[model samples]
Target chain A: MSDTRTSAGVDNFAVSKKMFTWQVEGERSITILTAGNLATTQSLISLLDERSVSGEERDPSILHQPTMFQVARLVGATLREIIIGASETGQTSADQFGASIIVGGQIKGGKPTVFLVYPEGNFIEITEDTPYFQIGETKYGKPIIVRAYDPKMDFADAIKLLLVSFDSTVKSNLSVGLPFDLQIYETDSFTSDRSKRIQADDPIYQAIATGWGDALRDAFQKLPSYKV
Target chain B: MSDTRTSAGVDNFAVSKKMFTWQVEGERSITILTAGNLATTQSLISLLDERSVSGEERDPSILHQPTMFQVARLVGATLREIIIGASETGQTSADQFGASIIVGGQIKGGKPTVFLVYPEGNFIEITEDTPYFQIGETKYGKPIIVRAYDPKMDFADAIKLLLVSFDSTVKSNLSVGLPFDLQIYETDSFTSDRSKRIQADDPIYQAIATGWGDALRDAFQKLPSYKV
Candidate 1:
């Protein structure tokens, strides 16, 4: 989300870039959606990019990793390293450099998966019990997903559900905004199956946001009112 | 809200008490709904209570305030003082002392009003533009209120709206639990018009929670799906 709104002391509008995708196509692919501390995230991504193209022998880039777990570890380690460097002076940078990433995709023989990597270099994968992972400004949009999530739901439905989630977040938090970068990966296909950056005026996103709000009002009215 | 669920290291369950009411009958009245840290708020409330009943000079309780603005200032000052005191002692009570309060009611010959007091000792009163205030675990339930709130809404409808808001919050956050404390003050009557604690087994609350979920799922299904 873009930070189109802000209060007095806090601003997240500087960030419009929170999603990144890397793939070797037909082999393995990863998509990283980030939140928090732009400088730290940028540094982390640049370092990974440099290592990927540098052909350096001493260090292994995320692309060279064998599995999703390895990719998580590499990203986690790099994040910790960047944070440590940023915070070397004191707690200021440590606080300022905190970042989180959602690393998702599939490696060659593995099923498609998603993970939430924390600032501390530790991470957890989304399980069958919890099919989706969201980080940063997540609460406002959570209830819809909580009520509506289904493992068997089709990708189109999944996209609609997420748009509602993101729409809810965007409505409530000034820090999150459109256009949102969305990517889809098909199981066994080691590449981004589809992707789009939904702009603020995008027809589909507008429909979803307005439609969801209307639906909520309609739903609220339909509920049996508490007899006071 | 209560904490029935928690992740690895976060807990907001310390608060089962979030509603406080003060009324002098036909003269004046106020109800303060709090969210955020426990100790600081407890201290703030205790200070107000202490001053209210004390027979001392150099003290002005929240009741002594001439206007709701003054009342907001008093509460905000108390909150800021508590936070500063806690922070100064280096983690003794500071880390757990952050708090926020919503002060609302009517004063004799004055219009009914609401103010959201921040931890920083500042507050913004509710205006025609936004008729309600919510603090702590507020996001999950906000969209509903945003859609349903109306300045001209009857008190009965207002209560139902809030229940839905609280219901959404309770569903998404285990920290916000059942048996919620509620107080309603009629505009001219001053003193609390009505109050109730919706218990875990409260049939009405249960129905609302379950019905809301059902309504939401129904609403989601009704929305036009994306044509992928």
Candidate 2:
């Protein structure tokens, strides 16, 4: 094994090599692809923290204050604490020496955002046109997110969508087993009550688990198969 | 955040939860799924060291021998050592804390396996028809494995699928970045030489990345939109 260290610091939000493509109402909107590295996070935070010449950190005089790095730091710190606690208690195990966190939401006056947080206390926010967030072993669950996500989705819909996403991940990755803790807050509601921990045997989640697996198999069967 | 320390050990020829899953052909083939706290790495080593009916400790025998817990210890030790090294290099600032390992594979003549290695150096394997493995922010990348995994898949195909799976994960989770280290060995290959470090800018990977994202969007657009 190569001696590569898998630690994310404040400055190292490595953008995924993958490009994110989306089409809305027959129009294509492709943002320049970038990973959530420390530089990107810092730049974003700086833009968000910029006040019109006053130098006041939290200046309200500006019409739009961006989400600062401090905000990212605060969010990263919260997630770090959560994962640390989880690891200590044996709820979640780290792989190759790291945990994963997805922290996304709109800051006041900013566009709705999404970010994927590394175990090293760093983050990357998703942009508006592509408004969704995913963490853990996510590929098994990504198709659903791509198929179902909508910018106008209400918090309820978003939470359900996220649950489905989590369900897909759990089914595919045993390391990411439940009970899952989900929290969904409205854009402006800083404090919300839409958080729930869905256990492995939770009824609603069970329905989703069985329903989705069956639906996927059925869909696969319906698709054209390759000729031998 | 609940405190629950669950541990399991695989004895001589004994498989742990690290490598259990159901394989899908016309039916599901379950792999490993042993459960118990005392069944951990230390206990398994002790069990292996025990004398046979001849009152003499058996030599290291691969036949009917249990998978080694030393593998988990190695992975954990590697992670901890890397974290320490990174901290000394100023690449990590999080005080000597955080990290985990997911170690799993098959022992010769034993069932193929999987395990989630904790920071404390214990592990559990997966046994069942689910003949695959994953580590890191695995939640985001698991769906593809569930939908597309076939136990009889050629090693090439399986590795490709895993690459794509990892692609989805790196895209969705910041903690699991690349250049990714991937290794694929046939059941009997004593050494894993198929291993390669995947960087973000690799051309073929770039193609898969763009293709997957585009395919997802195309499929999404074709889906019937909900009438909210």
Candidate 3:
């Protein structure tokens, strides 16, 4: 899942998709959620798409990577290349071109997996103990996920959990806003049909946003008050 | 209320009080919560205390500031003095000597009030619409406060709300930890007996920490799941 709100400054924001998905029928699927310099992220994604379509016959692309880890590596390498290239031009420091990515999905023989790729081109796979990754204004939304996460949660519950988290973040932070883009990739199923964009006026999103606040207040009230 | 955990670096944490309080017999009371470079904050508080004790009889001290805003101004001036003094010495930049403070309580003839003093010696008072201020590690703990704050809440519930906020922060960030110091000042009462240090093993704190997690999970389960 990714939020569509892209910000250039505290007072400047626009709706833009930050998620890119590539799938080849039932053979393979990959999804990337990006957060960072919009220019760098867009260029990196375009490079990946262009390479997958026009790479030298012997020079394999992300679609040709055998495992999820290789796919993450390819993404990271491409990001590092863009940043390094920008730095070499003397226009901006490498830091200004920094970007982070969360790459997930299944490819042929490998099971569904997720990896967090840092700006420096290194990556870490998500484990059962730490099942999710978030970037760009994360702290306000973290406590809920830390408290409520369960690996056994079904897709419905997982999406609910994320929306609640995003609602909390959006309420507390101005930079992150509504119209969240959501995609649910089922294990071993290389399909892209379960994706949807949650607009600000979406009834279900509104209900969850309003309902979670009331539910939290109700829960807070049930906790024993501190004694004087 | 102030959390006692202080950090010099991510791995270097120690128990240190960050809250200072002053009160006069049935006449006035004041409290200051600080967060920043420990040396700067400590020195700033020390200056406040020293000046209050040794200033010329007619010079007037924080105890004689007449209003919470003046006290805030006094605190901010003291902080600026310390930072400016250090900057003048050429030992560190002004930013390195920066600190922030939250000053709250009642002075004689003044209603209970709170002011946030920035390092540059400016301040803002909290109003009915924005009833609270947090100085450090704010974002991880902000959502709960934003959702649950109420001016009409009794002191006990207010303390419960704060503990829950602190608990959420301590759980999510390593730089913040247990053993919180709490002080409750009643309006116009001018007494300071209602203070306690919440130790790591304190049963009530333990219960709130454990119970809040369970309560949050319960609340999460109660939220309506998103339909696919």
Candidate 4:
């Protein structure tokens, strides 16, 4: 990210990536990537089913159906090939391989799942306790998640929270400018149900951004200052 | 610097070498560690004069006075020697150079100053525009400064802001634990008039922290949620 870029302008230094997965049936699985690299993205998918990496000890009582490492390996290999091909064609680069995938969805008998895929091909799943995943300049929007996030929140609430989160991040960090690409998948749906690329001037997002900032300033002013 | 060490515990690390100088009059200086180095318990003094590092061209209209490179070199050399010696004695390590020296006060005709000395020995001054310096886990406390910091703020106000800043960081990051060493230096005062180690149980600090968190949560709740 160039230091010269101001917070006001929309500048894309490198691509930012994230993936999400949903499970429809006990046997069926689907993965979505912000940028296509199935091999690297698959590591995230496998993380969901892998119990050992979840920091959870082996306990039959917990009823863990581990994510298949074989699936992860397959995904990783595919992503490596895709990245290599993109590099050769000058469409992507080894250094510019920037993307974070949020993978979550139901798989067969198991409940719905979600995971965060890092650039280096490793992944961490979001348990029921920590239900959201954010990549790139996450601080400005974190307060919203910290306050509003609850495991029982429905998909609609999640989408609202995500938009607010992205809005705050975009305001604070120039590297994370938009047009933002958003994809929403319902549980049990193999296909992407809704997707949109939100531009900088999108009306709804602009409203949220302005409103959040003004609200923050007002709230701050209202807080009691130190009395010395 | 270890995560296992609590705020209440005494630091296991000890300084094995020391070098410092105190400015008394017109460039009057005395080297404290010209012979044998003092133990970690001995606090050293260092001066930052206009002859220090070269100043960046801010606005062409604004008068600039650069800090002396010699002062920076001396401070850096002393810190490096002490830190290395401590590490060799198994008290700390290259990575564990966590102490930060606040090297700022007036020198003759110059304004009072404040700086955060990095482990690498480099330093950045806190000017009127940027009025505070923090060495560790600065994120949580940043909002307070962003909202409250002003160049003309009184020293009392500055101290209050610093306490709030430190409070936020301590709450968020365990690595930046407290029993904080706070020193307040007034303008034109060559030596620190008030210096105190604030413990975890300090009542005033506790009240501010608890009050700030509660205020934040209250403000967040009052914000308008998504319309849809």
The predictions' CA RMSDs to the true structure, in order, are 3.0, 15.5, 2.4, 10.4
Cα shift from native, residue B185, model 1 (Å): 1.3
Docking class of 1: medium
| TM-score for chain A, prediction 3 | 0.95
Give the runs in model 4 whose Cα sits over 4 Å from its true position: A1-12, A15-101, A117-124, A134-144, A147-174, A222-224, B1-70, B80-102, B116-120, B147-164
**Model 1 per-residue lDDT tens digits across residues B49-147:** 898889466888877788888888898998998899889968565546778888888778688898999888999988778767777777898877777
- Candidate 3 on B68-182: residue-level lDDT in tens? 8888888888888888888898876799878899998897788998999998989999977888899889998999998998889999899899999999898899988878889
- Candidate 3 — which residues are off by over 4 angstroms? A57-60, A87-93, B56-60, B84-96
Task: Kindly report which residue pairs in candidate 3 clash with one another.
Answer: none
For residues A89-201, could you state the per-residue lDDT of candidate 2 as single tens digits? 56545332344434444455454445666766787766667655544344666767765677886555555566667666555544344555554444555433444555668
TM-score of each: 0.91, 0.40, 0.92, 0.61
Candidate 1: stretches off by over 4 Å = A1-15, A91-93, B1-15, B91-96
DockQ, every prediction: 0.64, 0.12, 0.74, 0.15
TM-score of 3: 0.92
**What's the C-alpha lDDT at position B203 in model 2?**
70
Of 1 and 4, the candidate ranking higher by TM-score: 1
- lDDT of each residue in B97-148, candidate 2, tens digit only: 4434345455544544456655444566556665444543555666767776
Instruction: Compose the digit string of candidate 4's lDDT tens values, residues B54-135.
Output: 3344311101223433344455555665656667878655665445554554554565554556655677766666665544
| Best model number under DockQ | 3
Interface CA RMSD of each prediction in angstroms: 1.5, 6.7, 1.0, 4.1
